[model samples]
Target: MRNNYHGFTLIECLISLFFISLFFLMLSGVFSQSQQIFQRVESREELEWQIFLIQFDKITEKGTFRDMSSTALIFEREELHEGKVVTLAIKYSSNKKYVYLSNNGGTEPILTQVQAITFDRQGDAILFTVRFLNGVEKVGKWTIP
Candidate 1:
């Protein structure tokens, strides 16, 4: 007598299950790593923002207003070397998606991924509004001293 069964044996079944679980384990690890990378990127962007704010505060602290518009803030500060006043302009370029700092005739971009900026005078202060590319908005007041 001969008997035939078309089915997986216990060892075969166990091996297949183990391989499937291993695949899932690797997949979960990849997912977790991706999440960690995203979190790190987010924190780095926040750090960049903090640095930008510190630089902006330092530049505008004792600056005298020269001119201001919706897209630019021009100011003058005395040079420490020769007692000569130098013109500085903070300009937001919608086309370039950056905030530029221009000293005298030289220009350099200071902040990036900016959408729009507005400067308005309020009493003895300047009310500034910044709109970021990700739809975040910041409003602040800078008083001239």
Candidate 2:
């Protein structure tokens, strides 16, 4: 009796297959979770960047620099309402953690979760800074005659 069997036993093959399947299953789960995390991060970053841009764009238009402080800005915008000039007030409230724009006796918030806002002037350039709740900051500049 010379049985020269050179193949894996049925039980051994089943065990190997089970382990391989488990490993691949775990790998796919980890990859899927990581993908979700990455997507969320990307979306948050885009939203943060847009918050900065929208606030700055709103203020860069033609307006009289009535006054400004470390956390607020007051200006008379060159906008017309009912065939009359209008002035708008813009400011960042640390207490509420939001930026507000008010015009014609109406007030509304523009952005939220802002930690700070500052304005400065150098030569012909008006500079502004915005700080977000996550400790991120953005600086913007506009030239004025």
Candidate 3:
């Protein structure tokens, strides 16, 4: 008499499950790492764009008034307060690897990781070159009417 059975034994079943679980674990880890990297890149880009917008807005707000030096840019804003004309200064300081804003006497940092900054007065336009910590350089020009 002869008996024949075609089936996986208990040990064979356990080994197959173990290998499949290990493969899924490694795959999940790779996927999670990739997601983290992508998020980091996206956030950095968003922050940089926000900084760029703020810089441009503050500089170009009134169209035609500024005092600029090698390391600083100042904008004078005048508004009627309590029936009296009040003048305010918005100063941008390119110091300590940051772009700082100061009003009255309070100061705040608007941008960081700056490598260098240059302000050039070209006729009626102000051209600026900003160098970032990652060795990236950006040039922007604004006309002061």
lDDT of 1 by residue, 14-71 (tens): 9999999999999999999999997886676577667777877877875777788878
lDDT, candidate 3, at 59: 49
Ranking according to lDDT, highest score first: 1, 2, 3
Question: Per-residue lDDT tens digits of candidate 3, residues 36-106?
Answer: 99788657845875777576676457433658886666776555464433333333454577766665567
Poorest lDDT segment (10 consecutive residues) of candidate 2: 76-85
Relative to the true structure, candidate 1 reaches a TM of 0.72
Off by over 4 Å in 2: 1-42, 78-83
Tell me the tens digit of each residue's lDDT in model 2 across 1-145. Answer: 9999999999999999999999999999999999999788657856865875677566656567676666666777655556566777777777998778877798788767678888787877768787778677767776664
2 against 3, candidate with superior TM-score = 2
Each model's lDDT: 0.83, 0.75, 0.70
TM-score of each model, paired residue for residue: 0.72, 0.60, 0.58
Per-candidate clashes come to 0, 0, 0
State residue 40's C-alpha deviation in candidate 1, in Å: 1.8
